[model samples]
Target: MNTMTVTKSVVMITEEASFRIKEMMEHNEEQDAFLRISVNGGGCSGLSYGMTFDQNSQENDVLDEQFGIAIIVDKEDAAILEGTKVDYKQSLMGGGFTIDNPNAIASCGCGTSFKAAARPAEEQPCE
Candidate 1:
């Protein structure tokens, strides 16, 4: 079994993203909560990223803190999320969060949907 350790910096959040997260937490009355990151199936690209304020974390969750904010990522989801960067951008259209995941093989136009990089054994030529 591989015993590689996941570093706390596996996922990086920009300064602007950190500020926005803090603001959101203050708005939701969850300032003391952790920012939970996850991925789930069923999106247009077969996977979707999720984020939410959580009061508690699971036993196997990986915990990290940056820019004064706490974050929690599931161990299983870490592989797909590793090397991901979270940022906040402001524009005439307003502000929003952007995710840049290096492990994504493809992404849907909707933006939140993605297909993770497949393992070697799972890679096969398309018919």
Candidate 2:
């Protein structure tokens, strides 16, 4: 896909979050790596969000740019992640990145896990 087409899509990355991501990239000497975002199963909430630095993009990936960073997301994951925003916050305890996903119906107390409407809860057999 063309850069212009990818740039038109919306995926927000706050300035503070961008700074931290860039810092990590610099620390690892991965200047050419892009931020890869994905959603996987097996969290307490049935799904979890994962972020990592990847040097390659798959053919089915949806590439976008935000705050000067290349963000790649799987085509399947993109549908559930639309209108998501990521930010970094510093508190008395420490600083960490936070993800706010509008499409989430539920989230675990730990904050890294979430439940989306697309993945309905399955009934477990009685013990």
Candidate 3:
């Protein structure tokens, strides 16, 4: 059973990030897909963020739309991701998406893994 709650500003997506994501969706031919953001256990810093294009929503998923894009976040992860901001940066070297999470107390050197203030840190060797 999938339940959706329309949230206001649960996650912030910058215009640059939206443009890049839209371009990627078009390139992958997944225009109808929803961008799902999830927090999973077992990163070097107890929590890790995952993003993928999902065609369908799962049980207890919260839905939000921004910059002409549909976004979903699992109910279980809402708290950890609340007030998070997603941005894309371009430099002479390269370009990539960066996440600014207020709940994250510490993040690994890799930048994808983080330790939330409400969660205990679990250190694991990065594979």
Candidate 4:
């Protein structure tokens, strides 16, 4: 049986985001690479989204597939990333992969750090 399956709270990948990811993988100087998402404690607001191409995945990493792309998220961070969509929007000014996270109660203008609504009250500490 297939143990891994995409859930309704999957991280969607847009065509533009797929193209960019594919390009990054193709030109990757490293032999093994995978996209990783994690929550860090440093942003204009509070938490920040960390994205990087990794060569290894921890045993507790949550594996997800979208648009033929493999995504890795640590178990501890999965809750905050689920239901998030990675999309690319282009305009005359600029464009890049934008992460839309339903779990985020509020995100700064940079869209990097976010405060998850479900986080422990003590962790957020009322702001």
Best by TM-score: 3
Q: Tens-digit lDDT track for model 4 on 1-127?
A: 1244443434667778988888877887632466787877766667877888887777777777777767778888888887788888889998788888889897766555678766632233222
Residue 6 of model 4, lDDT score: 41
Q: Please give the RMSD to the true structure for each candidate, in Å.
A: 6.3, 3.8, 2.1, 4.5
- Regions more than 4 Å wrong, model 1: 1-7, 118-127
lDDT of 1 by residue, 56-98 (tens): 8776788788898778888888888898999999999998999
For model 4, the superposed segments whose C-alpha errors exceed 4 Å read: 1-9, 120-127
- Error at 125, model 1, angstroms: 23
The TM-score between candidate 4 and the true structure equals: 0.79
User: In candidate 2, which residue ranges exceed 4 Å CA deviation?
Assistant: 1-7, 121-127
Better of 3 and 4 by TM-score: 3
Q: Which ten residues in a row have the lowest lDDT in candidate 3?
A: 1-10
Instruction: Give the per-residue lDDT of model 2 (tens digit) for 1-127.
Output: 2242364444578999999999999999886788888888756677878889998888778888887888988888887888899899999999998899999998877665778897665322222
| Per-residue accuracy of model 3 over 24-115 as CA lDDT, tens digit each | 99999999898998888877887898889999997678899899888999887888899999999999999999999999989998777999
lDDT (CA) per prediction: 0.80, 0.80, 0.87, 0.72
Better of 1 and 4 by lDDT: 1
Model 3 TM-score relative to the real fold: 0.90
| TM-score list, all predictions | 0.85, 0.86, 0.90, 0.79
Cα displacement (angstroms), candidate 1, residue 63, comes to: 0.6
Error of 2 at 40 (Å): 1.0
